[model samples]
Target: MKDATQTIRRATFAYSQLYARTAAREIKHPVEGVVQGEIPRWLRGSFLVNGPGQASVGPDRYRHAFDGLALLREFILSDGRAWYRHRFLQSETFQRNHRDGRIVVSEFGTAASANPCGGVLQRFISHLSLVGDFTDNALVNVTPIGDQLCALTESPFLHRVDARTLDTMGRSDLRNVASLHTIAAHPHTYDGCTYLVGTRFTPPRPKYVILRFPKSEEMNGCKSFLESARVMAEVPMSSRLYPSYIHSFAITENWLVLLEQSLIINLPRLLLSKPMGAQGFVSCMKFDPERKTRFHIVDRKTGALHSANIETEPLFVFHHVNAFEQQGSQEVVIDVCAYVDDALIRSMYVYFDGWTPKTRFAQVRRFVLRLQPGRSSVSSQLIRPMRSFCEGGLRGDMPRINELFNGRPYRYAYLLSQADDHREDDIFLSKLDLDSGRWLRWHCADWVPSEPVMVPRPGSEAEDDGVLLSPLVHASDECRRALVVVDATTFRQLAFVEFFTDCAAPATFHGCFVQAP
Candidate 1:
């Protein structure tokens, strides 16, 4: 009787594993090339440019675990045919220096691999490559002592590199620092000195510190600078509360806004797992330069941290946040892609008035600008229906918004739409009109397009109209990637640079467009 009971238990476990494997594959892979005829004619051009074939394993990886009986069951039920593969594609560029004509880009890559049991792992590792002479993501400090760019990697140390040659000029590693998540440069207009905001994580808590660098060309050669640096503020997570992580940040002349995102924990990793319900929140703290004290703390209910405004309400769950300060007023804009039911739903364009000391966090107002789809006239082709299979909703009608940044004369946000057949991805560029709260579809592409960078035209200000450089994956090879430049104002194709790499997949993170000055 005991032997029979054990056999029956084993059989039941095996059956469950097989069922889970089928559900996982079904949720991931769908039929491709189903919506060729539904695409608009005007938008169906060479949307993606292919790059050179380069095989490099992406820096990020996740562990797939299966316990004793569960492990045996997964193997018995695994489909031998289903496999995953991905190719890398270019994303965005950022200009580091304006005086010396230096620029850099944050390159993004994608990978296709097996999902043993768990859901898709979302991780971003950017490569900082120089366009002219500037290192990617480096914050440049222009002062009378000399010009320098400060760069910090996901590693332990912060390096000061030459803004002209992109060479490492000096390095500073914080003692006992584990993960250096973010670095910010605060430039003092009066003395021309720059302050650095360095945030690091210890075991169960996070600490925020501000390092002040003297305006001198001489390297201090001091390792204790980080220790002696002022502690701006710190927030510790209670054992019951979710772990606190700094996702992103924004800074103004008088105050610095930090977005603290919460992580979910203590959930079973088995079937039908919900991660967002893991409990999350956002904490917005304003730091005053004059008083050197914490001014305000605005707590938000569960959402990813995106952008914020000193004068207005903070933007959450966004890809990018940029602020432009005018005469006495400030304008804040955000680009965000919204996800629903574990799928990319719609992209949003948000506008905030500006920061005001008297304004409470709840007093700030928010406006969600809806995006327009590609105006295609292709209706004669026999394409599959563009609707979600699980929820029975129109897929094309669903908003597939992803990321946003500056374009040219206007702020641009990007949206991604999967064809009915699920073979290709379409990218839509939307130009926002701030005054009227309207978003116009600036350009649309049929090929799988990644995030775009707004390359400023020569002699144009940061707010001026520029060109949209987008990297895309060609539908034919399933491996080739290309960079296509579109005019920001007219949405016309300006240039196409083909890369040698093949089978490059789209990236979830955002990109920056940096033009050589």
Candidate 2:
């Protein structure tokens, strides 16, 4: 149990120190100019990204990947020039551990050291600190809701930041609007509403609520949050003790599809396990090989839930590629990066230890759901699956598709992959053609890639008519970081703005490009 968890902590520290070393620093000074290549004139926006930067709080290092403190970076792209700014997302945990000098609060998966005083006060302080309520670091992703840039974790709250500058504004408490304390990092933003799942833990049955937050210029990240949040649907789960771990979902023309994978989190253990000297969130649950994966298909317009539950060989899924309803049929094709077993989640604990977990790579497969109207019965099958040509590595993550074809049929998916499974240190930026069984890949010798973001060319008519912006990092210790842009249709290099700081940034998870207004 401790081996995998222990390995991850050691790996994070070693990786951060060896290559892209990071430290907590918030400065808005003019960037040190070492940029290469030209900036596309049509590219006009701020690319805001978030990820863990502080690997250790003091001499005491973080025990889990999720335990590291969140860092936010903002790159302003306009007129063929870029300005860079970075800041750490302010958290109660960071204040208590890093600044004030004590690791008193336990993180999502990593438990803190016992209080100096091992009496009733220690127990009291422990319970006072909720598991993910306020203490969870929102390092996973960033969502631009209305006028606010929201830094997100699986936790309910969204930490707000000033868009223009990477300044930590405050936290937008979702408890005021939705009862659910947990949600996936991925939210689908449509015409004016951001569609996301808000799940709550209640007695007997836990409810998953579809929250549609209406966007307005007036929604400036402070007030009337609930008034703008419309509850689209609320579906109850089968298990009361566990909650499903979902990183993302899918949307089609008329339906919003959510796949509750076999990975179930133990809520009771997350609440009580720390008291028993056990790890928090990640340690509390076990993978259920018996249970079937569920597909909760909800009507986007009518808010009717078709619990079109289906059964198939169990697999673990984190990111979704895309989903669209098939023409002239009651079928929806959903693409996801699926792992054969729970090793990927478990390997989050073991990656650093040099012990290879079997299912680290995930294969990108399409699951077609055939839904029956009245009863909502459904069946699924895998479509033309995509695999990496490098060393039998087929797993994919950090999936991205064109926003224009989000709820419609899409032809391409952009994500990170690897060629050699044995040497897992490398990364390849891959663009998959869904229409044709082919993929285009870009790899730099020692350089790894971050989540690739797509920015459509102005007045572009073709679906693939856009530019791909990804963090090209670790080209070498000397040339630590660069934001590389590539042609979407051809997957060729367009331009890149590099970062030449004393301290290089760690891996980034997710971000959104906000077009300059």
Candidate 3:
């Protein structure tokens, strides 16, 4: 009976997906035109009727303090009513201060959310400057070139700019060179080289490629330094389906571990049917320059590569995957939140082993490090109101989690949870026990913390080892965002520096922290 029920559910989901796709196609027709009008009062007031009794409807009439509804309404009222017709504004950019005390930041523009007349409109928009100004699929690196800082937007063509003046210094196009996505520095190991990894999207199946750029004559006055550049290796997989690469890469002496994650959606057949559910999984590919790229089990084995797929049961939609050293063992951990029934629950310190399977492409073992009641909160009524029309819908907000080092035995992980009446969206720093599953938490006092950037201590030997530097926005004034420093090990407050301008909404992008040499 159970097997029969599951089969029926799967069939229903597949049908729904087809129907949703069809509806999406029809709505996308140009004739419907884009409707840029206020989200009707009925929709705005819907929050009040559906929200919990304790829900504090701000001046904008929304439960949350962030006036996203008002922003959406303003976008609708604007004259630009066509598809992709909204103006973009400069939002937040991730920055890293290098050892030399120079700052490198990726500047981009953002757009306000809006509803269209009759189309499958995107609820979220990517930063416009990244897509519009920079070439599609450009690997942009902003760093110090010589005496001046330069922005090197590479898409085959490399454009250099003076970091201080933001002036163009030089331009060189490498258009023939496929494309690169992830870029990283080799800490103190490489004097004048930047390592980059990217997948070749235009091919039989996307293959991972690694390249190295050395300081060259062309980069002399251009601001940055690279001695030489060469392709390291191309990683190929037997599977016909392309692997969806994660945003970051883990580099080791002998291997380059890349995390590939994806979500499988099962839709029902009926028209207007809702999605049944989704499953998420991740795999690790170990690439060695001397040998072919191989797949490894996340847990339970040694360095042996496996061929089987490792499924993360009870999918926790995640964004970041990080690898760090803990208790003398190299451990890889992913931060994710799963939807339990209707409410979203936070889970941290998920660990994986490096054991491999007998089959070449076999499955690997993975384990979630169980920590003491760390950041576990019952679903709040404010955000999970039963009467709300979109009550059970996904929040559409991606949780941010990153590593912080304080020169201690245990590593620290930071996460921000939805705010409550007594405590605003508070920051919780967890001291993680990667092996034993024991952990402790430190909640920031009187401040809502944004995603944190782990900045290395001024004289630290390891680049990966650093203190946690985060932008904390006071709950009282959402616009008043400041940079706060915390001890990664103890989660102790160190320093808070106010910024001149208001910081934009938090993002999931990794940030760099450079110290003046």
Candidate 4:
């Protein structure tokens, strides 16, 4: 029995090593196919997704998933068929790193000073400007600002991407914009106004600036959108040293919800310890038990944050389902896949045997926080209205919804969770009817899914009126992939456009569907 257990462990380790060694290929070819019954004929648009693509530049491969080179993929839907295209975001750093055959600039969770490029002059010249703007691998989420689509990351700069060709045009300098060290990848858009968070992290004082930009490209054509961005609120964080590791946030009709996790990013420590070496991202953070998780709620129209500030126990979250203000009440409902501590985060630095599957579940839960602004007498403790959304079953990170229902009350949400409890790489698509705690799941045998994007039907009345589009990754075979469109109402596969490539399509994170006119 002991020998059998050891054998199984060894096999698992071998499989993981093989998977890590194989980097996704960069190939694009025309894909033609009809759905089971053909799409609405009205469904024409491109789904643009971004993630880690080229893991190997020379002899070294990326140590962590976050450090991989950003690859953008496009599935252009038209006439019941889909066209495929992909391109790596060729930032100056990507170009320089490729030219030098080594990491020339640092990544969020990566190091770069120790390179053969030069002794001291090269490193000093590189640090003249922050490394983030240089290493613009927008590998997180995609959103439109003005006429152009922008790929967002933790870095403040938004990498402008050509929506049609999946090409990186350039970085948005925001006309020499001030006040930013890092920004959230996920931003909320509604009523022609987009809400995003940008952190201003200095040595002794760190602050958050809430930005509201016009979603319309009509005004300035397709130029940089940040030039028109207006700072809605500027609130200083209590942690004066480091910025909060906020990847995403939720938005209601009247509120912008920012979750401040205890995973505090200490810049001094990150630079001093060489975070990527052995400690990874975990070493950069100093989790304070006493520093309770604070919910910083800001008024959307005005920059009032102190009015609705609240607190709860420490919980790290990557995504949000939806936030809605309960009609005829003073309460706002927020849904999140909450983690107990930084265990999920600590394991993100997966390298060789460093990779371990987490059997612990991240359940979807509802949080109720009542707010009576301007009342100093009222307490800010969160209230719970329900126990569980899926009866403690749902697990995943990226949760998506139809843009039409964003910042408003909605019923359905799409998610990506573990295919099974044991394997973290393989995933399944889940459709959660928020009204009823029921979930419908669809999956393919060895195909891993990233975040699912909901493409809404034109002139549709129902909340789940559109289809769900997910970029499914073939596990053993990355050379083949498919764009799956599932019927929103039935949760069944309506159509799929399968394509093959010489190389693997890089793993995708979040994508957006620009509806065809």
Best by lDDT: 2
Q: For residues 1-517, could you state the per-residue lDDT of candidate 2 as single tens digits?
A: 1111021211212222222235546656747445566778888888888887776655555656566788887777888888777788886666777653655566655667655546987665665454453565788898776556788888777877777667777776677777767878888877767888867887778878888877675356746543466677887777888877777888887888877778887887766765576765678766778776777888987789875665566667888888888854478888888876666655554125555343245778877777776664434432223333222444468888888888787788888875544346555678887767578776555556778988888899898899888875563463366677788898877665677777666767799889987
Per-residue lDDT of 250-304 in model 3, one digit per residue for the tens? 4333234444443211111111111211111111121222222222222211222
Tell me which residue pairs clash in candidate 2. 4-349, 180-199, 362-395, 390-419
Ranking of all candidate structures by their lDDT, best first: 2, 4, 3, 1
lDDT of 4 by residue, 419-496 (tens): 333455445778888889788887766555677898878889898888988886666665767778888888887776
Q: CA lDDT of 451 in candidate 2?
A: 86
Error of 2 at 55 (Å): 1.2
TM-scores, one per candidate: 0.42, 0.88, 0.44, 0.87
Superposed Cα deviation of residue 42, candidate 1 (Å): 28
Q: lDDT of each model, Cα atoms only?
A: 0.27, 0.70, 0.28, 0.69
**Off by more than 4 A, model 4:** 1-25, 33-38, 117-134, 215-224, 271-282, 327-329, 359-361, 377-382, 419-426
Model 1, range 457-500, lDDT digits (tens) per residue? 44554442555555454433443434455556665555444444
Instruction: State, as a TM-score between 0 and 1, how close model 4 is to the true structure.
Output: 0.87
* Per-residue error (Å), model 3, residue 232: 1.1
- Sort by TM-score, top down from the best: 2, 4, 3, 1
* CA lDDT, candidate 2, residue 465: 95
